[model samples]
Target: MKDRVLDLVFLVGVLFKGLDGLAELVTGVLLLFVTPAKLHQAAGAATAGERAEDPHDLIANLIVHGVAHLQHGSIVFAALYLLVHGVVKLAIVIALLIGSRGIYPWAMGALGAFLIFQVYELVTNPSIAVAILTVFDAIIIWLTWREWRRGRELRTTWRGTVAWVFRRRVAT
Candidate 1:
């Protein structure tokens, strides 16, 4: 039962990683086609109704505020960042799902790096999304470490169990 629960958690974590990758990929693609002026206009248009309904709407205000700070080159940099992260994360997810023993470490390293970034974002920006992402990434990192350790133990035990069978048994 414990194994099953752990497996489920791993599955959820992997699925979340895939989702995150897809989101980044899509956002990056959109960013590639957007200019700061156009993005700001769109943000204003999108949030106008919400802002009108509630002038203090946190989400609407945040979107407007964030868009206001976008510079000409910011979109390009962000697009590149998201695109690279998306591709790497998707590759890691695919490798992990294919059951590559060697990918576990790589996956952990990539995820740990992202988690650190997310933690920094959470601290500096303090958004709900960043906070949730930070927590989930932390959980996934722990689960990944557990998974890697478990794999090593299984391999070790199997090797130990099979070693005696390979040796010649003396006739008694």
Candidate 2:
């Protein structure tokens, strides 16, 4: 029973990690196309007319708009990420409490690293936040790979309900 509970917790963590990875991939792809100027406008920054007199006004205007849009999108994304992150954290914590535990150290280390990244971003340049997010994306990808490997191993070793459902779908 305890093992079953741990398996469920692990599955939830894997799902959340996969979702996070996909979100990061989508965001990165979007960034490749959406210019800073358009982001700034989306964020409610000043229009081009507001700062037309300065020689570098065009660049500044673009930055302002881009930053604004980035900030706005960041807020929404951050909130959703935090909620899922908290749930994953809680699942791990609970699993540890139940003694299905060897992952406490890793969990703590990952949380600490993320917290430090956030603090550093808050104190320094906002642009640095993008780099921190990229690091997280890498972490999520790694987690996703590990989870997928575990799931694959389980499929070959056990005739679980999940495998049964997947097999049925594939047959149809």
Candidate 3:
């Protein structure tokens, strides 16, 4: 029952991250072709008036602010960063879903590192989205660690069983 629950939780994480990666990838590509002025204008228009009271108004404000002073170099850097982050996260999601034992540590490390950065970002910029992402990353790191420990135990048990069988056969 615990295993099932863990598997379900892990699967949810994978799916969530996979979708996030896809969104980031798409956004990255879009950033390449859209001018900052156009982006700011569109975002401003979308967030104008009554929309300011919406829950996601902060996100819209952030986007408008970001593109308001955008540079070409910054656009390229942001695009590259989003693309790499999306690709790496998607790969991790696939590996975790497939139960790749070797990937557990790497996943934990990557998520842990990202969590640390998110924490810093939260402190410096203090966005609700960043806070949510930090929590999610922390959860993933814990899950990966637990899964890795489980894998280690299973491997040990399998080795012991194999060794016992071999000894029994030799004595027979």
Candidate 4:
């Protein structure tokens, strides 16, 4: 039952991570084609008459604010960043699903580093998305560590049992 719950959590985590990757990839590709003015206009249309405190309003305002600050170099940098970040996350999701024993440690390390960065960004910008992602990453890290340790214990126990059985046969 515990294992089932852990597996479910891991799958849910992977689904969210995959969605995050797709969002980055799609947004990056769109930014490559869409002008800032067009984005601003779309944002305006989407948020038309929305209450100031509405989530959509907040997102639309943020979109417009971000577009307002964009420079040509910054746009290119952001596009590349989104693409690379999305690809890396997608790869991690694949590795996790495949149950690669060696990849868990690397994933934990990478996620831990990202969690630190997320904390810094949250402190500076205070995005709910970042906070939620940070929490997810922390949970995933803990799960990965537990899985790795469980594997190690299983291997050790198997080896010890095998050795004990062989020794008993030799004594007989």
Candidate 5:
């Protein structure tokens, strides 16, 4: 029962992560298209600041903005890869835990390392960190879905066992 509840929670977390990924992807794509001057104008409109009206300055601004977006996009892609990998690892760990007699210490260690990697990324490259986080989110979602399915199967099997036991008691 505890496992079932945990699986459900994981699934919800995964779904949220996927949504965050989609949102980042959209934002990155938009950044690629939007001009820096236009972005500045939008930003300035929201606050009192010296408006950049020079064309050259606008070009420089656009270049910097574009580069930032490119970097962000690359980071996001890397994060997506990591997330998928993490999800796969989690699923494998769960399988090993259930199908085998004992817990796999190595899998737990790997999870710990993965978590550390996430923390390191948070501290070092926070600007594009969302990209990595989103990727992990997608992986978590996938893992959650897998766990939910496995939980359903286990539940069904348990129900069958209970029914069989009830029948045997009645017969006795």
Candidate 6:
């Protein structure tokens, strides 16, 4: 029963990661074609009503302020970052979904590294989205570790059972 709940949570987290990866990939491709000026204009247009209603709207202001200072180099860097992040995430999701034991450590390591990076980002930028992502990554990391330990235990038990059976057969 406990394992069932963990499994459900893990499955939900993996699906979220897959969806986030696909969105990142699409956004990366879009970034390659869109100019900073265009992004700024779009942000302004989208937030026009919100800004009018409440000029200090946090989300709307953040979006507008962020794009207002955008640069060409920033766009390139963002695109590359998103593309790489998306690919890694999707690969991890695929392996885990397929029940690949070898990938358990690899996925945990990769996500641990990313979690560290996200922490740094959160400290430096202090954005709500980054904070949320950092927390989510932490949760995923915990789940992965738990699952890995569970898998290792199962493998160990299976091996012990097999060896015991082999010894009994030989004695008989």
Find the candidate with the highest lDDT and give its number.
Answer: 6
lDDT of 1 by residue, 102-172 (tens): 88888889989998888888878788878887888888888778878877432343344345334424422
Regions of candidate 1 where Cα sits further than 4 Å from its true position: 123-125, 152-172
Better of 2 and 3 by lDDT: 3
Supply the global lDDT for candidate 5.
Answer: 0.50
Q: Which stretches of candidate 4 lie over 4 Å from their true place?
A: 49-59, 152-172
TM-score of each: 0.79, 0.35, 0.72, 0.71, 0.36, 0.81
Can you write out model 3's per-residue Cα lDDT over 20-114, one digit (the tens) per residue?
98888888888888777777787788767636577467667766777789887888888887887788788887776565689878878877877
Per-residue alpha-carbon lDDT of model 5 for 37-62, expressed as tens digits? Answer: 55555554533232245535654555
lDDT-sorted candidate list, best first:
6, 1, 3, 4, 2, 5
Candidate scoring better on TM-score of 1 and 4: 1
Model 2: lowest-lDDT 10 consecutive positions: 152-161
**Backbone clashes per model, in order?**
0, 4, 0, 0, 1, 0
Off by over 4 Å in 2: 45-66, 69-172
Off by over 4 Å in 6: 152-172
Tell how far residue 56 is off in model 2, in angstroms.
31
Best by TM-score: 6
Superposition-based RMSD of candidate 5 using all C-alpha atoms, in angstroms: 12.1
Tens-place lDDT digits, model 6, residues 1-172: 4655565567678789999998998899899888999999999999999999999999999899989999999999999889988998999988776667788788888888888888899888787888899888888889888878877432343345456557767999
Off by over 4 Å in 5: 46-120, 125-172
Lowest summed lDDT window (length 10), candidate 1? 163-172
The C-alpha RMSD of each candidate to the native structure, in angstroms, is 10.1, 13.2, 9.8, 10.1, 12.1, 9.6
Give the candidates in order of TM-score, highest first: 6, 1, 3, 4, 5, 2
List where candidate 3 sits over 4 angstroms from the true fold: 1-3, 48-63, 152-172
**What's the lDDT for residue 61 in model 4?**
70
